[model samples]
Structure formats: structure tokens, C-alpha cells
Target: MNSMTRIPLTQLDAREPKSSGPQQARLPSAADVPRARDTQFKDTHGRRFSYLRLSITDVCNFRCNYCLPDGYQCSDKTEPLTLEEIRQLAKTFAAHGTRKIRITGGEPVLRQDLPEIIATLKQTPGIETVALTTNGYKINQHIDNWKAAGLDQLNVSIDSLDPQVFQTITGHNRLHEILTGLDRALELGLSRVKVNAVLLKGHNGDQLNRFLDWVKTTPITLRFIELMETGQNPDYFAKNHLSGESIKQQLLANGWQQKIRSKDAGPAQEFDHPDYQGSIGLIMPYSNDFCSSCNRLRISALGKLHLCLFGEQGYDLRHLMKENKQTELESAIRHLLQDKKASHFLHDGNTGAIQHFAQIGG
Candidate 1:
């Protein structure tokens, strides 16, 4: 994978942050800070990183069978970052060499003022592209505003296309709404739209090819993620789960020629289907273990930074934020980034062993 340059986008003319005092004057080397104790900002080959997925909230609107438990609740002791705080954090990362900013959430669209949030991040001096991931529940309603507010791209989570199957998997009966939102996001010029489909063993795993066929109708990139343990539905996955390698083999069997394509150092280990119009993606947090090149750090909705998806523990940046210790806050966040877990916990997508995606930001 080609290394993307890590540099802060200088804001020629931007509003002075509401936080008052300037964010710490960050050094370029500061970008190499670890999340807590396990991972690093650079890989073994000494590649400087630039992109980061910043979760704005952990409270998702949809309770997908694979993502959360039935009785899941947002941590009562802590809360999602305020608009100002998120902007500040983005600014801090930008100052430390963050270029691409992706705003994620339980479903970021659920945030009423998400447009404002995107706008806040765009104003940061070093932020290049600002994107959002959502279940598309509210995309049709606010997509225009989102684009108008400066959102660069979007990745919609769509598990199935079969109306009944979709409803059964997502708990909410809104396949048409999600599809409409995807179209609307593209129509409004959010060009880089991707559909994220979580592949399961018995659930919709078998229908992956059908989904791939449907995505070829548009330019939208289709990414098939192997369902792993990041939720309460352990029994479901335990009985019916497919690894990323298995998914790739199945695609190949269906006449999907797998010619590995070169691209950015992103999460999805991408490939091209020479025979198909659009490319297919495989994100094997299990089968293809990209943990060695895992440069992303997750910040929970309640404000804890996880060093790895399978992280055993995370430093409480929330407390530092709450107490308003400026220097400590910056130092603590940098320390967390420097301590990013080098390896993930396990390949098994189980609950007892690994933390849920909601808690870690998928």
C-alpha cells in the first residue's frame, strides 16, 4: 500500500475557535502518539499516517443483529462530546497532522446538529476531507443540509436488500428509506458513497453476490465486512459466521475475478472484479489481519479512546476533558495515540473476549 502524506491542511481564513485559547501548537512528530499502550501511529516499515476515523457518538439509531445487544445503553457516567469539544478534538488531531476526518456515530445521522458538527470540523486548519457514516435513517431528510454544510462523502450501512430479510436483520423496517438516502446522498454530489454490508454465515452471507450484482448498477463501492464479535449476539455469530477469506473465495467462485488493485492505505483491503463494472471490498479484521497497518484509533461516544478494537483497556480522556486541563488533555490524548495496540485481541467475533463496535467505533 502506498503511504499517504501526513500534513495538516492550513486554514487560510477561519473563525477563532469558541474554546477561546489556541489549541496546543502541535509538532509534526506528535501525530505518532499511540492510542494508549498497544498500537502505534506508524507501522513497522516506518510509514507516517494521516487518516483517522473519529466517532462523534456511540448511540446508533438502528439495532442491527450484529452491532448491539437488546438491552444496550449508552454509558450513563459519560456523554458524547459536545459540538465544541468534537471540533476541538478534530482541531487538535489536525494540528498533529490529521488530514482526512470521518465523523462516525451510533449512526451519525441521528445527531440532530450533525450538519453543524461537520461544519465545525471543516473549519479546522488541517482537515482535508470530512465524511460521515450512517444507517441512512435521516439521510433523506437532512442530506441536502449535510452536503451544504460541507460533508465530503458518506458510507451507508446496508446489510440486505430483501425487504423482509432487511427488516429481520436491521430490526427497523426501512430498506427503501436507506436506499433512497443512498441515492439522495449521491444525487446531492456526495460522490464517494460506499455501501458497507456486514457478511454473516447463515444470515445474509450467502446473498453477498446478489448484493454485489446490485451495486454494479451505480458507482457506489460495495464493501463486505466479515461479521465479528462486537455486540451481544454471540450465539447468532457463533453458529453462523464467515471469515473474510471465505467470502473472497465465494466471490471468486461466482466468476468474480480477483485482481488485487493498488490504492491508499485504508482499512478495506480492496480488490477489483475485472468482469464486473464496480469493485468489491473485503474488510477482514479476522482473515486478513491488517492490525499491523492499523493506524486508526477509536474514541467511544462516552469519550474513551480505544487503542485497538480488541483493546483490554483505554485511558479516560473524558476525565481530562471534563476537568479542563489544557496541557494534560493534549498530553493524555497524545499518549493514548502513542500507545495504540499493535495487535488486535482475537479473530473470534465474540463478546466476552472483544469489546463491541459501538464501544470502540466500527
Candidate 2:
């Protein structure tokens, strides 16, 4: 809608690979690869996708130093996909083996229709889970309504437990309010509730014990995600990119055991400890073979399909999103899956075209 280049479905097979740098291994051409069956969404590498991350909006209010330190600025004038568009997209994906749908955004609560969106996903035939990732700005006021609307899982971004440090990181002092909302979600009988903290060096990198102590008593999974380098933050990444492998070693030494990943689980390597009431999860995108078990796909706030979070481009599926076009939409999606790469090139210092996490709901 903003005049961005929309890669048509017809050219999916004819388009050449984006790059052939040393970091990128020469993958087989699209013609040489076997296409996935129509019923299931499998890629050329034998990876089957069953989870969808749908970003409803790219507008956020946070001014975190690592992300939008300068705050959000609108680069495009296009409006995000409407509620009907999102509902149709979700139904299509659910029909094609997508069991879980996670609603994300710059802060998804910014959308007033979020409750209806959650309810629609829950009522869809093949969807088993409906999750939302938010910054918790207004969770206290909305959690009750969300739960009643059939929200199953919730992940809140709480970067630190220390109030002052939290304020410094998120540019807000609502830790108490957010934590209260998190507890309320548990009390409301939500199946799962998790906390996500992006590990930033010189900020919360040395504060693992603080997180561990809190999770020791709380019945929740606290996840530490390694700070990822985006197109907009190479300098910040260089200054504060902490590795999760160090945290993994520390957990192992402390007697935490790695758990087997379920078929539809996220990218985090989860661990459990007998002495703790909660669990720990580490999302180290830079680690070896990190993308081997990818089971999720991302759809932007616009209707483009992103095969990988760090891929070079997005394929436009909106053109085929009209009524009675489910057949064409499904075919376009399946054809695009054939070109998904074996892995991301993050290890090679390539962050692809992802200017920021908000763009694709990382």
C-alpha cells in the first residue's frame, strides 16, 4: 500500500537468491528443490511450520535505549491490516496446520480491537492456542477482558526487576504495575504466562541472579533473549551484545536441566530445575544451529509473509487476500515456502533487512 516492492507469487521461483557471500552457503536452486505438499506448510529443508507471529501494528510507545531510543517515527503512511484482514489471514493459516497464533506489535495493546482479534483466533477451528506479547503498559486494565475473550498465553516484556534500572531501560517506571498484571494473568487461569527480557550488556547482563531469584518463587517462565543486531542498531549491538551461552553454562552449573522442545514450541531452549517453582528459557539466536528447529513463520503488520525474521525481503500476499481467494492465498503461501533458506546469516554479522524488531514483531 505504501508503494513498497511486492514480490508477486508468480516470480517466487524465478527470483535468484539474495546473496552468495562466504557466510551464505550455496543452497540448491528453487527448481532443484522439491515443493511441499498442498495440505501441510513444509519448506525445502523439511521444516514444517505450525506457529504464526502476526504483528497487528508497528506503532509503539516505549523508548528503550537498545530499540527505539529516539522513540517511534512513522516512515510509511500506510495503515495496518484491518481486523477483517487479520481474521481472514488467521483462518487461512489455521486451516493449514498452524496450531498456535501469537499476536505481537510495537505494543499490541495499542490496538483497540485486540480483544476481538483474540476471541476470533480462539473460535477458529484448527487453532489450539492464542497468545499475545505486549509491553504491559495497559495490561492491568485489560487482562480481565482478554482472559474472558479466550486468551490462552501472555508474554510480557519486563527487562529488569529493579525499579530504577527498569525505568532506565524501558524509559518507564511501571514495573510494579506490569508485575501486578502478570500475577493477575496467572490468577485468571491462563494456561501459560511468560516474561521476556532482552539481555543487554552493562544494563541487565549481570542481573541474572535477580531474575532467577524472582522466578524461583513465581510460577512462570522467565526468558532471557540475547540482544540481536538489527539494521538500525549496529553500534548499540557492538556495545551491549551479551551472549546467552554464558547464561546457559551458568544454569548448567547450577543444576538446571534442559527440557525437550515440543513440536510447536518457540525458539527458546527451555530448562527446568527441581528446586525452583518456575523455569528458565534462553533464546540465543547467534548460537550454532539455532534455526534448525524453526517451527514458526511471521506476517508483518502489512500482509507480507516473511519466511525468516532476518531474511532480505517479504513476499506480498495481500493481493490474493480477497473473498473466495483462499485457494489462491494458500497456493501463494506454499510456493513461497519453497524458497525459505536453511538458516539465517546472523553469525556472519548480517542482520538482513530488519531495521528494527518492531517491524516484524521480534
Who wins the lDDT comparison? 2
What is the lDDT of every predicted structure here? 0.65, 0.84
- TM, every model: 0.80, 0.91
For candidate 2, the per-residue lDDT at 260 reads 97
Model 1's number of clashes is: 24
Residues 185-284 of candidate 2: C-alpha lDDT, one tens digit per residue? 9999899999999999979998999999998999999999999998799999999999999999999999999999886566799999999999999999
TM-score of 2: 0.91
Candidate 1 wrongly placed segments (more than 4 Å):
1-48, 69-77, 253-264, 319-327, 348-355
Q: How far is candidate 2 from the true structure (C-alpha RMSD, Å)?
A: 4.9
* Candidate 1 residue lDDT tens string, 87-175: 66676567656678888876777678888988988888888889888887867888889899899989888888888888777788998
Candidate 2 stretches with Cα past 4 Å from truth are 1-4, 8-38
Q: Give the candidate number with the greatest TM-score.
A: 2
